[model samples]
Target: MTKSGNVLQKINNNYDELSERYNFTILPRSTRWNSVNRLGFSSTYLIRQGRVIEAIEVAELYTEYQPKSWQAYESLAKAFEANEDNLQALKNVKIAVRLVDNEVNKSLLLAYINQGDRVNMQLRSVKSLTLICLMLFLMVLTACNNDSKLDFDAFVEKKLTDFLIEENAQVASIAIVNDKLNYQKQFGEFPDGTKPHHDTVYEIASITKTYTGLLLAKAVVDKKVQLDEDIRVYLQDGDYQNLQHLGKPITLRHLATHRSGLPQDFAYTSADIKSGKAFELFSNYSEAKFFEDLAQYQLTSMPGETFQYSNVGANLTGYILENVYNQPLSTLVAQLITEQSGEEHTRFRLEPSEISKITRGVDRNGKIAPLLSPHSFAEGGLTSTAASIADYMQYLLSTQAEEVLLSRTLLTETSSEHGHAFFWNTYEYHSANPMFYHSGGSIGTSTWLALYPKQKLGIFIATNVSANNTQGKLNDIANAIVEKYEQVGQSK
Candidate 1:
């Protein structure tokens, strides 16, 4: 057998393992293939040993396990042909041909099926062998094309270098697969010309929203907050009495999903947010001021009327969560996310040693931006190392500790058409697998994190300089990684 076939055989060798141990495993027993996952291997093995009845039974089980799998249908067709069930064999082979993705593969299988003389089928088996060889050749060529087009490590290095020249960014990024750190790289350096290590930290601006969303999901599971219930109960009555519009109160769901009908930001003007004073302004921006703004402000539409991106709404959600848990948002976040995800260096506030590892953010003009003050502790305020973020992402994609990770509950779609899940966005297309993503930007930094859970893939990119078009750049990098990930994973 060839290397790829050997890999598939090894996967079949470990077929009886439980689902939770699926990290980095070649073939995760997908939901549809759960019942007779390795039966294809067993059926082929048994058919060669002249165990026709046993092979037929196993092949039938394989078909039931994944009715849509063209391979399973084709295997069953072969088993039927071995058993002299020519009519059943023809029916199954036709179905297999119909279900195939590639036209070439389908045509080859159809030609193999049209050879009706079972007496000379062994001679025709040479055609089947040739078809397999051609199919494998095509797959190799396709994989090579995808690799050249979507070399993720190369793309990140190139993009980071471009940012260094164009945006003057000091950037670091990493990719994780199957709970292991696969790529760790950096470009440029701190203004003082210090090289960044794997432990170097960066501000993950609105990317903090996904962490906040995870907290909300955990709160629901803990019965600390009801997802669909109004958040007014957690807020002081006087502070939220006028928050409603036409008697419609915003729920916790509305706030997390950006449908809370709140404004995008506070009154922090450019003048107030001077280089070093931004943190002071954010910290001193009082609860009283927040309520006063809400009291005076008018809602143009009712809560949940539409999707409006709102930093205020997310921060308020964090604040209410603090109230409900009777703990600081920082502490709650540490316990709920950072600790659970095994991200030792990720937190809302960094200690002095942790601070030493962080790169200083440079403004677009190349001036060192003001270091974030302690008050910017929620919403867009998060500092984390690339390695830790990669580990956290792997933790999210892994099946282990799923109840605490809350991947399933968090991914329940609020808008299937739009593919919004909590604060994460999902990409839905016929040919593409689903992915969950979120991006963040602060004055001097930007970050994007995403997961293709089905493929057990995750990527994180962060830069010290906030570029003019960071989002577009992040999207391109992410798409490239996803394409590469799917190609490699599918081949395995």
Candidate 2:
């Protein structure tokens, strides 16, 4: 075995021993060369040895072994912090603080909690500093070397290439659309070293939500359903009295805006998802099983009052739409979206012959991951090519259809700069120059789509490697492209 593989195996063995002893409980005060202690020491040693990736792996394994232990979470948080993943560090530390029972432990965890704000401030400060430095460096480079200035296309290619290398990603497909440009490109290759083309297929994942939102808008425009109508009215299977909280029934709008007061998934917790049990359950999941779970689901808050991203809610919305239209989601998407957009290769279902065009995806651990199949069609499960997405972006950019407009209208505003429009996230809300965006992730793919309505600009990026930070990296790439495009426009 390779050196890294040996290290991973040792970590796994330590975790297994730890799990056998603790059994997912809080760690005791006394620790003397126990499995936990060994594992923790191993992680720390890795970090000290400048192996932050392996340190993170060990810490992640420890957390998975002892999920309820504050110490495990704290270790994971520190590992992430050392790796400069402040967002994940903050998240894990917050969970550690919540899980800590004793006052002494709580006090120790509170220090990390206090650092969250400092981390955020530092991130903002670093971004500002980086921007200033970049501008200054660019100015100097332009003065010194006239040929150093990169065009928008070259800038995108270089940035995406760097991103792929840094993220250890296999493939990236991107599209940018506007009045002056319709651009699409694919970078990197499959595990077999075969290069992808513009028409190479990829799972768009939750970007499918935007299409579902548009379908909902179409239903409203056609007078088939009311946004505020009780969703229970359409559910014909069982009496779901537990669906409502404080007498507020979940509305279609609530589902679209992720305010439906539903659990994130139908039958699994976060732990189950991390352990791959949720995916196993989803493999054989049927419509009947979905409704069965829904009937038993109790609302955590009043519908439309709280925002919680719920795959179950999204799927339920799709099911309701299916019932309203007397057609499947695949058909509705074909009729309303792909056909209208002239996205010939975009669909929920692909023919057997076309499946080969779908590029393979790699997981964070460098293993080939299974291609996601359609389960919740509305929440995710759409496949398309960069060229097809480019065409779709152009359609969205130019179309003045009522449904499209309604889909872009703000449904819920969380702040002056942020809001939800149907299923799309609206940024720069109060500024009138709204940008609609959404990110998508399946087991092994990540995607981001952004639309600047006033500017008539659209950007879509996708990678065949899904990691914790993949979507953020894609967002960064998209933003860089936009900045370069704007700069080019200003210069002209």
Candidate 3:
């Protein structure tokens, strides 16, 4: 048997062991089918290995195990698509679409169906082509009619409402900024039955990394640090011999660009967070604790040669910034970012009055979740509101500040489609229309921020709910809004 076959056999034989090892019980109930998820992954892997028939067989097994699941049908559709069986792909995807419960999944399956239809059209009979053309004509006519009546604000409101209902989330805030427009809105009410307004605060989570990145840019501009300088120069108290790999030391840029060989986090794991252990663990975590973990850390790969999303690296950057400026991170944020941006409610620390304004966050299971602690302030602890984030977005869109500009500069190219600046992920960096964006997720909230420099467009979206696919949902909403905005602009 092939290696893949042997692996599949072993997984089948040790199903309970795999379930226990992976802690399948911690997953959302809807996604608790560990065998189905693994089978889908195996099918994708087999397809990538050029084992198309085996891939289809695995997908078939997935559907057999979870016949009613849209995900299973979707997986099978993908396998058939890979095998160039457009008819089968379309048939499976249609079923997937029918079975899908949420708008996000339905939207995805519809796209696949549309693509498959286009491909299958070439092979259709002349009569079938005529019918398809008739359908297209009607679709175009309906779209044109809808476009004539489209209100950007109403469209956005509907999208946000659908998202809230689909995710069973309580509240969300969104801000959009461009040269011609500044818009902000809050949707839904808090658990207390109080409606969230423009200034209602919620944890922005890892979006805080962008602020840290901007601070690093300021340090570079001020000549306080060099991008390629060995980070150990500032860690004089500890012997971090493990911070280097293959004679190359981790640099400030490596940390900023996620190319530093640091672990994802030192304080807690995903399981810990799911089990409510992370809150306890972080309660006592300090700068000293972080450094102690760093001293014992081993490099997994050569510095600047790998891309690992490391909150530890981001926090370390924050620490380094603090050391260089001789100021606390909170003070630095106040002086450098929020103050300059005129963001009144954006902060690492909140007062009692401000705390009262913070919205309650809900998790996937509809339970109220604990707000993020301040210990990970640099990495994921900042909280803000739609109004303040609007100001921040406008600040980013209009500012010509050297440090802000430097922060958006592509520091490392991870792929043709993806790169990294100071900490922001970059897309199409070498093209005329470059973009910088980041997504953040805490235990109870998720957020996404994106900046389109060429378009002078910036968007910030946050929800008081965290789920496995919250970021993807937000990205879809952002994309939809951007598309509609462009359509409106063109129409005007």
Residue pairs clashing in model 3 are none
RMSD of each: 12.3, 24.7, 23.7
Overall lDDT per candidate, in order of appearance: 0.66, 0.75, 0.77
For each candidate, give its TM-score against the true structure: 0.63, 0.68, 0.68
Give one digit per residue, the lDDT tens place, for model 2 in 1-54: 222223434645665564444332234424222544555666666677777887
Residue by residue across 320-426, what tens digits does model 1's lDDT show?
88888999988987766765455666776546765565566767567776555234545777778887887678667753553334533443344553456666766
Residue 393 C-alpha lDDT in model 3: 80
Pairs with steric clashes in candidate 2: none
Q: Which residue pairs of candidate 1 clash?
A: 206-440
Better of 1 and 3 by TM-score: 3
lDDT per residue for candidate 3 within 171-194, as digits (tens), equals 888988765355677898876688
RMSD of 1: 12.3
Candidate 3: give its CA RMSD in angstroms. 23.7
Tell me model 1's lDDT, rounded to 2 decimals: 0.66
